[model samples]
Target: MKTETIGTATFETWTVAETADAFARDEIVLIDVRTPQEYMFEHIEGALLMPLSFFKAGKLPGQSDKRIVFHCGSGVRSERVCRAAIEAGITQIAHMEGGFAAWKAAQQPYIGTNMATGAPQRAPA
Candidate 1:
């Protein structure tokens, strides 16, 4: 997909490794745009929980200038979230190419508390 910028926010897309690199350098804020229940299942390490519905409800709680990389279960919802962020005037935005499933397929690490059992699980890299 073509990456476009809106005002001060630039939509720069990236692959899993590229996203991970940005996270490693502390240059991007990863936001999990999935539902709270899905987020509780598992998510990329260091990603913040910000449901897409929350943004749709006009409850964005972060700086617009922050570099945001959004992800969902398999990238569908996250893509919608990125578009919404752009519509909401967030210029610097991106979506994980393949979402959490892709991250897991790539053997990337993740952490989360089990929703059903409340047990914390850390995926092994």
Candidate 2:
């Protein structure tokens, strides 16, 4: 895939399988850039909660050298977050092509939290 720079960050989009492979190899960081409510509803396995609002507020944490992958309900918000990350001087980042919906559609496992119980549930296979 061709690498592009939105600001200071360099990002490359990827398919769900490619993202899974990267995660398996521990080569990338999966960041869920959706709202808290959406994240609580469902999200990719092992994804870190770094809402777009946090990025906008300039409170995102982590190393710039790590390969960061941003995702949301759809690719739109994540794309915006990716751009913001670039503007914040993060150099390595990317967005999932279709976001969490695509990941679930691809039969990838995800974590679903029970709002009432505050318990985490894994997507059934």
Which candidate gets the maximum lDDT versus the true structure? 2
Q: Please report, in order, the local distance difference test score of every candidate based on alpha carbons.
A: 0.78, 0.79
RMSD of each predicted structure: 3.3, 3.0
In Å, residue 74's CA in model 2 sits off its true spot by: 0.9
Give the Å error, residue 45, model 2: 2.5
Question: Which whole-number lDDT from 0 to 100 does residue 46 have in model 2?
Answer: 80
What would the per-residue lDDT of candidate 1 be over residues 31-93, giving only the tens digit for each residue? 898898888777777899888777662555565545678888888888888777777776556
Q: TM-scores, in order shown?
A: 0.79, 0.79
Worst 10 residues of 1 by lDDT: 57-66
List clashing residue pairs in candidate 1.
Answer: 9-91, 9-92, 10-91, 10-92
Candidate number achieving the greatest TM-score relative to the actual structure: 2
Per-residue CA lDDT of model 2 for 2-120, tens digit only, reads 58866555787878888888888888888888888888788777889888777652555565556777788878888888777677777776889888989889888888876679789
TM-score of 2: 0.79
